[model samples]
Target: MPGGRLTHRDRRDIGAGLAEGLGYAEIARRIGRPTSTISREVARNGGPGGYRADHAHLATRRRARRREAIPHRDPATPPDAYGRDPDAVRDFAEQLAALMVRTGVPRMAARVLARLITDDSGSLTAADLVQRLRVSPASVSLAVRYLEGLEVIRRVREPGHRRRRYVIDDDVWLRAWMTSAQQHAMWAETAQRGVDVLDPATPAGARLAHMSQFFATLSDDMSGGSGTVEDALTVLAALRHAGTSLPVAQVATALGWPPDRVTEALSRAGPDRLTPAQLGALQGRA
Candidate 1:
């Protein structure tokens, strides 16, 4: 429907919709804008409870002016090899950084990650980051350290270069996901300990127990072995097709997998973790 930056009237409408407790989708529908537009607008200004039309309009104008003042590229920088527009690329990076900020990443760290990931090499030295982000070297160093702590980026030195580079690997997200799962598991363990220390029958203990269970389940789901869900599902399907319990060796042979690999897959789809139907299918085997 409508396109371009939101007008002051649109911000007023968004404020009215928030006041009425309308959802983002409903507000966007009423204004002929995308739901994401409404969501980001509200999120950028304040949350639903604090959003003010005038404040939001002013903030948007300030952001626009700041963006306008930023240089898109350096004169010494080469053109994109694929001929993509530098301005568009810069805008997309900013959008990505904003989205990451909304998802709980610190603003500087998010900007660093966005810039690194958007680059063709997925790597940048502190100097490169400082120059490109127009931030101090100390700022880039802090951001990279934060990102590294999350396991989403790592430091490496080029073969002949003395300078260190912060590199985002292709599997950066996978590493970050696993890091999160590990954190959840740690929380689950701590919560369980709290439950024991407080006596499980007490109200506080019960709350801790629920918290422990929630995080434990989340950790299990997110921390599955190196195999993907598709691989696990395939193993389950093979068991289902067998119509009777098959030993690991037999299933491995049937699936053309090595014995150890099949064993790993079967362990991942353990009976205690399977659905009723899946459990029934593999009843005789562990």
Candidate 2:
């Protein structure tokens, strides 16, 4: 009953309902309509306090007339029915680039990525990017190089053509994620070297140790997926099983790994790797 357009009488009723201090849900129930319908009607017109029945009805009629005046396209029609809509593509590209920039992507890089991504062929040459983006060739070169370094895009050589086409593969995200993890691992190793060079008893060494621990955890979480944590815990669990005080070097030799690898596993294992029961068992045996 409430699906059709609201009548002047319904609008009057809605105004009256709002005047009666009724919430949108209660007003909707009284009018036999949905709460969202009541909410949208009030919001678009003016709001609860400012929504006048006559004004809202007149505004709704004007909107309806405006919408009716616009021509609707049939889905069966070709995309370029009246010729290519350059404005539509430009608006779409602008919005996509803005969205990328909001997600921490650099502005020019976002524009370049947006153009390449929205291309019909899903690939583009450096010249094509420069033309579409309206930027200099040098600018395109910088953006493409940055995107390539981040693994967000890759270059492909055509069979006959000489200019390499830049493309975003489906596995771009996976490759970028792995690259970030690899970088974190490299940083963590560097921090650990800092820890070794500085005396652990000093404040600077403690800070470096903490930094190393944080990066090691982050690296494992990114690259190790769930398996890395499980493997580290397994190593801790084995050590817990040994029930003997062993040097980290001795543990490394027994595990047939470099001392640093064993140390990394121990660092990643964290203090809470084992349950209280396991810890108590290890403690009692010790």
User: Could you say which candidate leads in lDDT?
Assistant: 1
The C-alpha lDDT values of all candidates are: 0.83, 0.78
Clashing pairs in model 1, backbone N/Cα/C closer than 3 A: none
Tens-place lDDT per residue, model 2, 1-286, is 8787788888899999999998999988888888777876775565665678999899889877765776754635444544666545655675677667667777688888888777767789998887666567999888888898787988999889787999987677788888888888888899889989997678998999898888887887888744366657766866888987578898877777677776767778765878999999989997
Indicate the residue-level lDDT of 17 in model 1: 95
**Stretches > 4 Å off in candidate 2:** 1-92, 102-104, 225-286
Measured on C-alpha atoms, candidate 2 has an lDDT of 0.78
lDDT of 1 by residue, 57-163 (tens): 99778766866887554645555889887756766686777777767888789889989989999999999998777778989988988988777899999899899
Residue 85, model 1: Cα distance from true site in angstroms: 1.0
Which pairs in model 2 have colliding backbones? none
